[model samples]
Target: MEIFRNKKTFTDYIERQKEMGKRIGFAPTMGALHQGHLSLYEAAQKENDLVISSIFVNPTQFNNPDDLEKYPHDTNRDLKLLENTGIVNAVYLPEVADLYPAGLKSKAYNFDGLENEMEGKSRPGHFDGVGTVVEELLRQVKPDNAYFGEKDFQQLAIIEKLVQQLKLPVKIHGVEIYREDNGLAMSSRNERLNAVQRDAGKVIHETLVKVNDWFRIITIAEINKRVKDIFDDQRGMTLEYFEIADEQTLKQTDFFYKDKNYRAFIVVNVGEVRLIDNMHLD
Candidate 1:
């Protein structure tokens, strides 16, 4: 696959491909390629004539400087994984300056209160950073369709809103959450966990499974308390937040509406490694 480091070169190439009438698919990510990320590529490839992706551990999206510093990066392995995909037509590796240019600053956005719940409430300015870098990537790539993982359900919702608010002409597709044998969601950050922590990580998904099972018979308030109680007793982990929210607005709700779509969102801090996952609660 062709690799373009220069922003204009990649943009020009995409433009040329568009002129040739090839439908473009994009999967933008930080450079820690895994099966979960590749799943997005597979999803894009099935629908588009060409598939492209970018590797930029966006500094803007990181609220904690330590997190910005600690976020994983293995360009060689990442590229090799992309190469192995065989379906990836091209790769874009943009420098911080290429995307940011001015400095490591994030542009502010109003996600219409969508940014004020769950992950947004925990990480200040996180969605703004997400909005800034994603807007830049979407504009530069300008693909007919962009793919995201449902693991980051909140982020996906915010990005869909971003596309609408910015009036970007691209469809957003959300792939299902990919997990490990232990049922822990696959993530680059998982590399940070040791064996025991990895075992402990299973609890996050385990709890979600219970949440899904209990949604039909239990009260939302009771489920919320039960989730909290599980993590409260879980060893070597902290439950950052477990929210049963409306699938669309993402607002945490104690009352489940009969006709509304609902999803369970969760975040857990395993030692220093933070992990997140979500499930469709029917």
Candidate 2:
């Protein structure tokens, strides 16, 4: 697979591919490659003539400096994993300087009401950073299609909005979340968890599953109480927020609307790693 660290070379290569009438599919990632990331590459491979994946741990997205510093990285291993997939045609590995040659600039994005809840409220400037980097990458690659996992369901919604607002000629596709055998959602942060913490993390998924099963029969307040009770009972897991929200707008709903689809979103701190997961509650 071809590796590019410079933006001009990467853009030139992409342009050449476009000239050849190739339909390019892109997967933008923050490295720490795992089965979850490879799944995105697999999905992209099926639909496009050529696939490109980028690994740039964007600093702009992190509201906490310590969280950014502690974020995982292993370039050699990431490339090996991508090579093993044999689906990625090229890999874009850019330094912070490469992405922000002019240095960082503050930016803002309006996601309608989607950005006002959950992660946005928790992380402050997180979605703005996400919007900035994703917009830049989409511009640089200019692919026909871009793939993102539904694991970050809210972020996926924001990206869809970003594409619409910017009038970019790319289609955004959200793949289903990849999970571990025990039902915990696969995440790069899972690397930081010890065996005990890893097992404890399963409670997050279990709680979501319980909510999914009972959401139809119970009131939203009872659902919230049940979820809190589960977290309180767990030794190592600390619940951040659990909400039943309209899937489209991501605004918390007090009652399940018969006309709208809903989802349960959860965040938990297992040891030092913060994990997020969502389940569709139909």
Candidate 3:
């Protein structure tokens, strides 16, 4: 697959593809590719004539500098994987200056009420960085469709809001969250976990599964307590937040209504890496 590091070159190529009447699909990612990322690429390939994937470790999105520093990267391996997929037309690997030549003067984004809970509350200014980088990428690529994983469910909601607010032409698609056989949600951050911590991380998903089962008969408060109790009992796992909320608005609700869709979202620190996962309750 062709790799373009220059923004102008990539956009110019996209323009040429436009002239050929080819529909484009885009998937933006930080390196460290995995099966979850490839699933997005595969989904894009099924619907679009051309598919483009980007790998830039966006500094603007990290609230903690150390987390940014600890984030994984391996360009050679990533490129090889993309090539193996044989569906990716090109990969955009832009330098920091390429995307933000004037430095990060982030614009404020109003995601309605979606940005004020869970991830928003824990990591201040995190979504702003997400909004800024994602906005810039979408502006640069301007693809007909973009793919994002449901693993970062709130971030996906915010991006959808951003597209609506900006009225961008691109269709934002949320692919289902990919997981390991044991149910640990796949993430680039998973690389940091030691063997023991990797096994312990399974508890995060296990708790979500248990919570989904209890939703039919239990009160919301009881559900919350049960989730907490599971993490409390597990060593090396710290529950950040767990809530059952409307799948669309992501606003935590007191009780699950029979007709509305609901999902359970959870975040935990296994070792020093933070992992987030969500499960839909029909």
Clashes of each: 0, 0, 0
Q: lDDT by residue for model 2 over 1-282, one digit each (tens)?
A: 999998889889988999999999999999999999999989999999999999988888888999999999898999998998889999998777666767885477778978889998978888888988898889999999999999999999999999999999999999999999888999999989999888778778888888888978989999999998888998877888898889899999998768999999999988778899999985
Candidate 1 TM-score over all chains jointly? 0.97
114-233 per-residue lDDT for model 3 (tens digits):
988888886777888888888889988889999999999999999999999999999999999999878999999898889989887888888888887888788999999888888899
Task: Itemize residue pairs with steric clashes in candidate 3.
Answer: none
lDDT of each: 0.91, 0.90, 0.89
> Candidate 1's error at 9, in angstroms?
1.4
Write model 1 residue lDDT over 171-210, tens digit each, in one string. Answer: 9999999999999999999999999999889989999999
lDDT of 1 at 82: 93
Task: Give the CA lDDT, 0 to 100, for residue 214 in model 1.
Answer: 97
Ranking by TM-score: 2, 1, 3
TM-scores for all candidates: the values are: 0.97, 0.98, 0.97
Better of 1 and 2 by lDDT: 1
